[model samples]
Target: MPTEKQPVNFIESALETLLIEQNALKILSTQIDDRFSQACEIILQCKGRVVVTGMGKSGHIGRKIAATFASTGTPSFFMHPGEAGHGDLGMLVRGDVLIAISNSGKSDEIMMLMPLVKHLGVPLITMSADDSGPMPKNADVALTLGHLQEACPLGLAPTSSTTATLALGDALAIALLEARGFTADDFARSHPAGALGKRLLLHVEHIMHQAEELPKVFPDTPLNEVLYEITDKRLGMTTVVDHENTLLGIFTDGDLRRLLDKEQQFNVHTPVSAVMTKNPSTIKAGMRAVEALQSLRDKKINQFVVVDDENKVIGVISMHDLISAGV
Candidate 1:
């Protein structure tokens, strides 16, 4: 068999593509001017949702852009122009904003939607390489993202152009995000199922072990009894509570080690209160899990007593819990 020509170096090819994309992005960045601001203003003033549309690869990027906008305080959704021609255009309302993506600015599918979009009095924003094309001429605001050669040796594939378009979409979304004064908490609210949301929105109450699951003993309980509760609960610690079940203090594995180092016999009957740290660091059930984790780190503690507004012990949360949740 003829030896196969050495495989085209895939890694080298990929690096070259990335370098081309970077240069393309730089060119697009320098082109950002008053038109970009005008696009942001149009989207900001839109009373209805943003409807993004395109064909082929541009369609995929448009869908992602729509999602980013939706999750970042801008109400948006993707509309396939082909689907729109087939009755999906009914989804567009009078006040909605339309963002049409086409590298060449002459996609037949996008051009087909322009008249309807105009008739509805919706603002049309076109992202295209050609500023003079029909789509740009019809659009209320044209975002010209072009002037870069493709990375493909064939020069037919949309390699650098798509990258530039994606970056331009990001810049637009971020500008709108800042203009809306969107914060991490606001982003977390929109993405409650994601890791960042878990860190920012989840609270001690949502994860802490409560009621009978809490390892607790009266302050007067013997140290051995406190150890028994700790072992039975498997939290490596136990809370010392008052008669009304209010948190008085906490004892942990660290405290046990210190006691052992002090030569205290395991059988010695010391009061649990004597071995516990009074008013140990605690967190409220409603506090954000991320804030709780920060408190734990700042105080150098592994466990926190979850309490109610009245200072009654509700539950306990460990550093391991936050870590397990990827917070």
Candidate 2:
């Protein structure tokens, strides 16, 4: 026999679930009070890594929290509770801080390891709902997610609780990051493969053309020769420098166009300095590539001479160079 077709409101149910989870996080925000500060203090004072543990869905969240903390200035790692009993418990040592998560404030795997954790003198921090349980009572500091229900319609799946827990974990990691005075440079050191790291760590000197690659000409160099330098270098501009290579001005393709528009006959024998733009914008070789890109945009220009402290032209940087390098 065929069963009657069931009618369902999937959109309404999804929106309701989002509302439930949203409220849980709002509640979680209010719960970041004294206990949260105390937990930060404990981790700050610890002389070793943070060891996070949880079971099932909580375990999954714990792994991410551990990764966030480790990347954001705190040294941390995640250990599965099931593995802890089988011998991973050795990963925790005296002076280390352990973070255990369970919505019910108790999980048999965590409970089984609690005694050994205590015996090893590891400070325990438990993240859970405020349910009376040994894990909460015995923890050095208990970060309660407070009384809350899952976003799941039947309240059987871990949804709102996990969201709240993840938020709390992020809050803790960022707080520690601020307390430690972590800077972008510090972050880049830990995340060298990320785009942000590249932006902060890369400099003009690392990418700018140097030495003979610079399209340069003497201030009195003939316009025809200057054209050769620009075309050969393919940078669309040629720097005008004196005998000591001190920058005097810049002659670009734009200048050539304007010159031709005004003059009936282009004179190849004219001095390069006669048509060059004097005191052209320049950038130091040590400036960050991203900073250089912003300067290019702000000045409404596409190229800059890489100059030294004495205003001597050393190299050139172009918009194409930065863009091609993913700056």
Candidate 3:
């Protein structure tokens, strides 16, 4: 009689699963060739959205692939194959491209909708294990994942195949992203609620302290009066400008500390220009907040004078403001 099987080491089993899936991905990478490029070209030429569809575990991967494509500059949405048969097929239009994902290239629901897809004249792109199936045969471009052994110990789960499919989807999305010259600002536009959006979209002008909020004084202003301006404005620094508002220099709390530490004599009525830091680093109001933050860090300073075309001090911006504003 056959004996009952003994339990295997849990870590060894896990490692084995990962190794199998890794090997599958290695094989899948080598399979990418002209067919992948053709699929990308079809998508590039599509005037409408790239509609993705799949069934079972493939459906889950399809949803993520569609989302990645959408966020990365490709206009895309996931359409369930089962739902497509029930009038959702109307989502597919003449200018659209349909990408169907099926490990075997023979999902019944996706197969059932092919007639309507063809009638609508939408380009069909199929991803599967091989190019022999009906779905691949009918596709405008067929992308294949090399034959993969399942990572499952019993060789039954969708482990390695799903990993390969997801990787392929990411490859396609990133290729299109580069081909379209997509920028961080473009991605930020699609994700305004995230940290990157705040960095790229927020401008120095939007957050800078301006007008009465700016602590500024003329070259002849008394040192005691300049301190009051810095205190009242709460910006920790004051711009020393000429009568015409052209920036001459700046004085900060740090400057006050260093000056007092070195000098033995007291002079409250000293002209700020005598001690101010001339030609301090400045930024334009139109600069992105992220760049402003970087400037602050690079210069080892707390703030910047926001200048215009003629180096006139229009506003004051600080690292504190950027951090508080989520930049």
Cα-based lDDT at residue 274, candidate 3:
91
User: Which window of 10 residues has the lowest lDDT sum in candidate 1?
Assistant: 263-272
Q: lDDT by residue for model 1 over 1-327, one digit each (tens)?
A: 998888799999999998998999988988799999999999999999999999999999999999999999999999999999999999899999999999888999889887888799999999998698888999988998768989998999888998899889999999999999999889988988878778878888888988788998998888877878989999999988898988899999899999899875765578887778898888888888888888899988898998888899999999999888778
The residue-level lDDT of candidate 2 at 267 comes to: 83
Q: Name the better of 1 and 2 by lDDT.
A: 2
In candidate 1, which residue pairs get closer than 3 Å at backbone N, Cα or C atoms, i.e. clash?
A: none
C-alpha RMSD of each candidate structure in angstroms: 3.0, 1.8, 1.9
Location of the lowest summed lDDT over 10 successive residues in candidate 3: 191-200
TM-score of 3: 0.94
lDDT of 2 at 294: 92
Q: Write the per-residue lDDT of candidate 3 for residues 1-327, one digit (tens) a residue.
A: 999999889999899989999999999998899999999999999999999999999999999999999999999999999988898988888999999999998888999998988899999999999988999999999999999999986877899999999999999999999999999889989988878789878999999999889888999999999999989999899999998899999999999999989997659899998999999989999999999999899989999999999999999999999999998
Rank candidates by lDDT, best first.
Answer: 3, 2, 1
Best by lDDT: 3
Model 1 lDDT on a 0 to 1 scale: 0.90
Candidate 1: where is the Cα deviation over 4 Å? 1-7, 194-196, 243-246, 264-267, 294-300, 308-312, 323-326
Residue 173 in model 2: lDDT: 96
C-alpha local distance difference test of each model:
0.90, 0.91, 0.94
